[model samples]
Target: MIRAVAFDIGETLVCDDRHWSSWADWLGVPRHTLSALVGAMVAQGRDNAEAIRLLRPGIDLAAEYEAREIAGRGERLEESDLYPDVRPALTALHDLGLRVLVAGNQTVRAAQLLRELNLPAEAIATSGEWRTAKPAPAFFARVVELSGVAPHQIVYVGDHPANDIIPAKAAGMHAALIRRGPWGYLWADDPVGAAADWRIDSLAELPALLEQHRGEAG
Candidate 1:
């Protein structure tokens, strides 16, 4: 039986329009230009950061991030950034007595902002804090360490199949593919996406699905 649920942040729990828009603004490009590049990268199965690199060739992203922070135009997360179903869905999981966690490829400041939102989660972590990113076995190993349960007892949910579903499954965790974001919808019908233990259109669908899992396990 699943004892815990961990969620990805971008386009899973949080809508990332503002995040990319900010980057476009910082790079002095039209928001739509950056947005189009992101979509193109997603379509090509390339890293999303490639879009930004394409905008500013040979740019050092980390240094640029520090510069943006110093300029007071760095990462910002607000309650409005969260998807409508996030609070209620997470609350329902918490009410079911499951350990709810938020872990994704985000920055330390993003983690702090998420905690400030006071979502119904036992813990919130990021790639920056762990110094690891998804699609990597070590990242999922860290996730297992954080969950404090057998990997099979935890269900990892995300909108990215390559990063979230495949790696989580390889790590022995049940994977839930959420079909919402660009990558989510674009690859929803792919065979790799079909490998997920569950495919959900919304987080609100999760509680009942987990209940069914419990019933089957019984």
Candidate 2:
């Protein structure tokens, strides 16, 4: 039985339109250009940051991020950025007596913004804070550490199969592939998504699904 549910940030809990748009503006390119490049990279199973590198070769992403922050165009997260189902789903999970955590491949500032939103979660964390990113065993190990539970007692939910579902399962947790974001939709029907123990279209569906799992377990 799953005792906790952990979530990814982008495309799983929040929409990334503002993120990419801000980058496009920073690079002085049309949003569509950067968006297209990102889509192409996703389709080709390449790193999304490769899109930025392709646009301006040898660009130091870390420096650019600091520059953007200095320019007051850094990562921003508002309640409006959250999907409509987020609050209701998280609340429902909490009501079901499950610990809910938000741990994703996001910046430390993004983690701060999420806390400001006052979402119903036990804790919120990011790859930037941990200095570890997903698809890496160390990242999931950190997650297991943060969860304060055995890996098998946790459910990792996200839109990315390679980063979230596949790796989470390999780490001994159940994985839920949520089909909402670009990565989610694109990979939903792919064989790789089959690795997810659960495939859901909305967070609102999670409470019921997990309850069903509980029933089956009992």
Best by TM-score: 1
Task: Tell me the whole-model lDDT of each prediction, alpha carbons only.
Answer: 0.95, 0.94
| Root-mean-square deviation of candidate 1 | 0.6
- Per-prediction TM-score: 0.99, 0.98
Cα-based RMSD of candidate 2: 0.7
Pick by lDDT: which candidate is best? 1
After best superposition, candidate 1 residue 61: deviation in angstroms? Answer: 0.2
Residue 68 error, candidate 2, Å: 0.8
Q: Model 1 compared with the native: what TM-score?
A: 0.99
